[model samples]
Every structure is written in C-alpha cells, then in structure tokens.
Target: MRGQEMEHVLEAEGLGKRYGARWALRDCALRLPTGRIAALVGPNGSGKTTLLHLAVGLLRPDAGAVRVFGETPYENTTALADIGFVAQNTPVYRDFTADELVRMGGKVNRRWDATLARTRLAQAGIPPHTPAGKLSGGQRAQVALALALAKRPRLLLLDEPVASLDPLARREFLQSLMGSVAESGTTVLLSSHILADLERSCDFLVVLQAGQVHLTGAVEDIVAAHQQLVGPRHHGEPIDGVATVVRARHTDRQSTLVVRTDGPVTDPAWTVHELSLEDLILAYLAGSDTQSNHEAWGVAA
Candidate 1:
C-alpha cells in the first residue's frame, strides 16, 4: 500500500535488526491504527524491545522502515514531537525532586503540559519535594509516567513500563495508562511479559515468536478464530478443515488439540472450547513443538 493512503498510526514493514551475527528481530510488519492500545507480547528473546525502540526512533531497522503519523520517526523532529516514550529504564535525574522534574519537562520538550504532570502526581499522592532516587520502584514508575503524559503526545510507546511494580502497583499503573488514553484519545503501544496485564488493558494484541510475528489483530477476533479441540487419537491424516493445530495432547483413548481455526467447529466427534488470553499466549510461546507424537501446526498468514 502507498504510504499516503495508509491510515495506520504506526507502520513497520519487513523490519529486521541484528547485532554482529545474532538476529534481534526479523520480518516484522505492523499496521497499528489510531487511538487504540496494542500489546507487543513475546517470550524473553522475541525482540519486543527491539521493535519498540525502532518504532520510537531510538533505533533504526537494518532491512525495513517504520513510520509514525505518516513520517519517518528517526530524526524527524515533528514526528518525535508527537510521540511520548517511556523506556524500560526511565530517563530521570536521581537527585531531582518531582518539582524539579516538572521544571525540566518545561525546559526540554516543546509540547510539555505542566498542569497535567502536576495533576497526575497529585492524584498519585506523590509529593513534589521527594527526591526521585528515594522513591519506591512503583512510585518511580508513576513519576516517569507522569512526565511522559506531560508531553500530551499523540502516541505513547512504553517498553516494559510495569516490570518492577508489585501487583497492586501494577494494577494502578495500568489503570492510570488506560485512564489517560480514554481521556485524551492517545494511541498506545506497550510491551509487557505479563499476559494478564495485557489481556485486561489492551484491545489489540501482537504476538512475536523467534523474531517473527505469529499473530496481530483485535483481541476479540483472535479469540474467536482459535479453539481447543478434544477427540479420539488418529493416524497420519491432517484434520479435515482446521486452520492450524497449535498443540496436541493424547491419552490412550483420546487426543486433544488446541487449534486456530477459521470460523468455528461443526464436527460432532470433536468438542470445541474457547481459549482464554493466557491460553492463546501459551500456544504462541510453545511455538510448534515437534517433540510431541501428536501434530502441532501453525497456518501461514
């Protein structure tokens, strides 16, 4: 598709990155729409952070291109102005107080909204006089979020933003992020290892496995297209019309499989069960396990 005709807020086409001979990301493609939260999910080595860094202009792709708001993100001042990024390790002055941090935002970013920063800090019960380094990990995360929101950005790119928080704090942080998106129509792309967090907070999901995109779409649509099937064991014939057998299990009399099928099940011999977000996530992580005597497959997109 032509760049000007695309409606995506963020676009990546055949993106790849490598360090020496080790591949960090490969064949990555995304067309993210506006005003929605997208979860960049994967296992530890699956390149979520690499994709995010490229999207935010902190890193460049070796083989492809990324565009944000119809323009290249790297070194594009106007595009950068519209993006707010909170890296895994937030950029903060350890010795600075909340008040000083707010002031720093004013002096640095052209789009800074001092009022929003202050209001968020106040709501979180974070004292302006507290030194940034002295705050708890959760508190520090909140402060970083406040600063990011202070820019009033059109898009927010967060890389493992809640990694260090406790359950309660993580909940609060996610709530805050969702609230901000609802209030301002911000487009958010966040990466997280926590499946439950993404399931609850994001409407759109992307699953990356071994540097390739396994699936990407609305959460509801993905759930609807996948199912767990249970039936008696069989020999070498492929399932009649199933999309892809994601995983399989067997007892002496029965064989059960998780499959991503087009539409739904109609056969009487097999029973279909809806998959949870967590189940879907695990299916992707297991990634075509061949050791099982049963067949596990992935349909090509």
Candidate 2:
C-alpha cells in the first residue's frame, strides 16, 4: 500500500489531439500522484473532456502519450481494469433496475465486489427494485457511482458527475463519493467547471486552457504562491518580486494585478491580498497568453 501510494496515478507526456482543422489538446503534460482527488478545471471546449477520454482510452491522442499506473491505457486489459470512469451524463441503462445494474457490473469487471455495491446503494437510499429511468437524477448518479465503486478500481475518473443535479443533490453525491474514497484509497481525477465544488473536495488542481496545461500543483501551494495586488496605475513599469503577471486590470487611478511570486510582497506601493483557489484559477484563464507565462510560473506543459 505504501508503494502504491508513492506511484503516479496518471502521467501525460507531450500529449496532443486534433479534430479536423482544430487542435483540441496540444503539447499537454501533467503528473497526478496516487491517492489524491485532483480537480481538472477549464472553460468549455478547453479540452478537459478530450483529456479525460484520452486518459481512459476512449479517445486516442494524435501525438505523444498518456499512461495510467505507468502503463498505456489503450487495449491493455490490466490498465483498463484498474480504471473506473463515470462520464458527464452519468449514463446507466434506462431500462435496467438498480439491482440489475449491480449484477451487470459484477459480470463486466474482474474485481467487482457485489457486496460493496449493494451496501453503497442501500446507504444512498436507492431501492434495488427501482428502474433507473424512473429514479431521480440524484439517484441515478448514486447508482452510477455505486457501480463504479463496486469495480474496486485503483483510479476513478469522473467528468462533471454532478453538473445536472440540484445543489442539495450535488452535495449528497459528493459526500457519497468522498466516503468511498476514504474507504477504498482510490486515486480520483474529476473534471468540472464548478469552482466551489472543486474547492470543497479536491486537494490537487490542474488548470487547462486552450489545449495546454496552464497550471498544476497542490491547491494550497498554488494559492500560497499567488497574490492579488491593488495599487496606483503604473503602466510599462515592472513590479519587483513579481514572478509573472497572470492578469491585469485598471481603473482610472488604480491597477489590480493577479500575480505569481516567489516570496512575500514587501513593496508598500501595492496592497497584497491572498488568493482563493477560484481566484487563482480565474487569473490564469484571464491571461491573454497563458503559454507565455508558463515558464515564469514554473508550470509544466
């Protein structure tokens, strides 16, 4: 277990994918450690789904490579068995009852644990006889998660799993997920546009913008390394100790800059404010040229 915890759950090296004339993802790379709930954040069409699909072997990269548990995911039975994926829609057979789905999972996955599946569903208040089509959205999501968890996978990949549910339902679903993570020690890679949800559940963060990895690190470390500075407008004058200006906005008299820095902001000319995870992510996304600032921010491609 200690050796497993030390291994990387996912790694991408020079990964790229294209569709027709557009490159969905390009020169992307990141390493996610095992036993972490890593949040993948990006705007729509920023290649979040593409990256997730590639990681699960649902889509192949046009260039470079992606590995799951140090092995290529494509057509590798061992690698495939180690991963459990819940897509954006939380798809389940509409005609099948909750009990039927559990049975199907047992048949399909080599490591399926039927007892765990039934226990999770019971805890979520899902009746075994209820048809998936007749169940509430939250119930269906719970059923899907139960199926995934039943597989006893080493890595779990969730793509916007709660995007369609109501706030209370979302909270419940995440609670259930966290409970499973605690019990199973599964590494999780979850993608979502909801920053608040990510803040509550995730310890690691990966920010992808325009097919490139803009930032990747521990959530607390990234927040600690960035600051928001408000000061008098000083166009064309560089601020000392500022590693990179992620975003800059100006009013008539003051300039507000979101910056990445190596140390404390001792410059009295600027009032420094600590950033939240949402604030830091938005700053990177708001940059006009995120690729240009990667080196300065110490972000890998």
TM-score (C-alpha) between model 1 and the true structure? 0.92
Instruction: Tell me the lDDT of model 2 at 72.
Output: 85
TM-score of each: 0.92, 0.93
Worst 10 residues of 1 by lDDT: 292-301
Q: Which stretches of candidate 2 lie over 4 Å from their true place?
A: 1-6, 289-301
User: Tens-digit lDDT track for model 2 on 1-301?
Assistant: 4476347889999999999989999999999998999999999889999999999998888999999988888777788898988998899999999999999988888888999999999999998997899999999999999998888988999998988999999999999999889788999999998899999999999999999999999888888889999999958577888888889999989999999988777889999998989988888888856566688889985
Residue-wise C-alpha lDDT for candidate 1, range 235-268, written one tens digit per residue:
5357655888777777888887878887557778
Off by over 4 Å in 1: 1-6, 234-236, 288-301
Per-model root-mean-square deviation over C-alphas: 4.8, 5.5
lDDT of each: 0.86, 0.90
Report lDDT (Cα) of residue 18, candidate 2: 98
lDDT score, candidate 1, position 247: 75
